[model samples]
Target: MKSALMGSLKFQIPQLNFHKTLKKPRPSFLRGRPRPPLWRAKRLSTEAIQAIQSLKLARSSAPRLEEVFNNKLSRLLKADLLDTLAVLQNQNELDLALKVFEFVRKEGWYKPDILLYHAMIQLMGRNKMVEMAEEFFGKLENEGLKPDTRAFTEMIGAYLQVGIIDKAMETYERMKASGCDPDKLTFRILIRNLEDAGKEELVDCIKKECGKEAGGRFFLKISSAQNGKVAVADLQYHVLKCQKARNFAVSSCEADLISTLLKLQSRRAHASR
Candidate 1:
């Protein structure tokens, strides 16, 4: 019986092999899907490369740079524009960068942002163009664009640099009056400057007004949308860490007093979005 079973299985093997040979292949679903170009991953397109090169070449002349920027408007991207701005900044050609910035602003595609404004403020500050920086800051406000805390700090530093301690202190008051609290860098700058100018009383007063000690670090909490519950200690600590890494020196100040905590609260009450 076992020998008969073995004989039957051997007889069916050739038929099974013939059926396997006649079987059809399965269809693929991905055959119609588009594949990304291999070269796109390696580098920018020829047009983009040319546009950036043209931007670098045209930085010497305002009218020429504007012409190139307009010509490449279709092909150029926001990142390309920002890169050109960064290049201009690196070369200490902030005026050129400002020209490009204004040109970009007039473009239909451009939108304002905080970081870009911050960069412009820093550039103007570094160049000792504090008056221009003040004007830019005002323009930013007029455009309904609120400068961030860092921008405020830079403005204060710029005022202090020009020996305009009154303006610096006024900027700080305006900052707190807007419900925006001082960060660690802000405190360090104001305190250092005030102490340097022998205004130890003001330094102590500011520290008492804005900060508290926590975990061996000073913490300043500003009024947020959710009231004053949000603490900026961690953020200030991180800012200090970055400052140390970049060797940012603390700033100083010297000016007359204007408002108290109540005045700042009242200003916050009158604040608009």
Candidate 2:
């Protein structure tokens, strides 16, 4: 009986061999999905590589570098890799900068210091890399560095550039929670962004926070929109703003009603739709 069982199993093993050539092409679904390309480990050529190496070395003694080290000079950031990455970014060699950043980040030596993160903020903000810039700012505290006023300002500015109002406000709130005081400039930026976002109510709130005398423009805009109530152009900005605010994945009745009311009141519904 054992010999019969062994013989039966031996016959099955040949057909079950994973290395065997297939008689027909397998269906796509059965073949499993293709893997995503890794952001790290992306190689650069010798010429593009030399361009990065040619960038000026950031001395450990620059003004921005000095300001950060002043906080806790004893705590050097894991030996200067991120520092070099910052210099590449400061020089506006972004493609080379990204390549170096990606490499160092993969090696786990590129921690986010204020200057390093600042360079990224300015670079991405200028280049309109909104999502990536926000991601960099949001991950700050987790990287063991406190974001200073400069970092906060640059981060908030990046969020505003993307017109992500909620994220900008969220970053401001995080700044305050980190025991950093928000100056008048911060409030002014928040108000300006709110106005631009068509959150008239939020703009007014921030205006009151900024002492209200400067809130006249917000009220004027709101009043004009109300007067031209039925014109398609009148509610255009507000309609887009509402579209920006919506969280569309929900199936809740309240979400549906609120969305319907907004559409009904909006003369620019077709545009948003």
TM-score of each: 0.55, 0.40
Give all candidates' CA lDDT scores. Answer: 0.63, 0.54
Clashing pairs in 2: none
- Model 2, 14: alpha-carbon shift in Å? 79
**Model 1 misplacement above 4 A:** 1-63, 72-74, 213-273
| Tens digit per residue, CA lDDT, model 1, 1-273 | 999999999998887776565657753211122334333444555664576577778878878777887788445676666565655554557766787778667767777677777767767876779988888788788778987788898898777666678888898988888878777567767877777788877787776554231112323344444564664322233223333322221221112111222233344457633
* TM-score of structure candidate 2: 0.40
User: Poorest 10 consecutive residues of model 2 by lDDT?
Assistant: 247-256
For this target, which candidate reaches the highest TM-score against the unseen true structure?
1
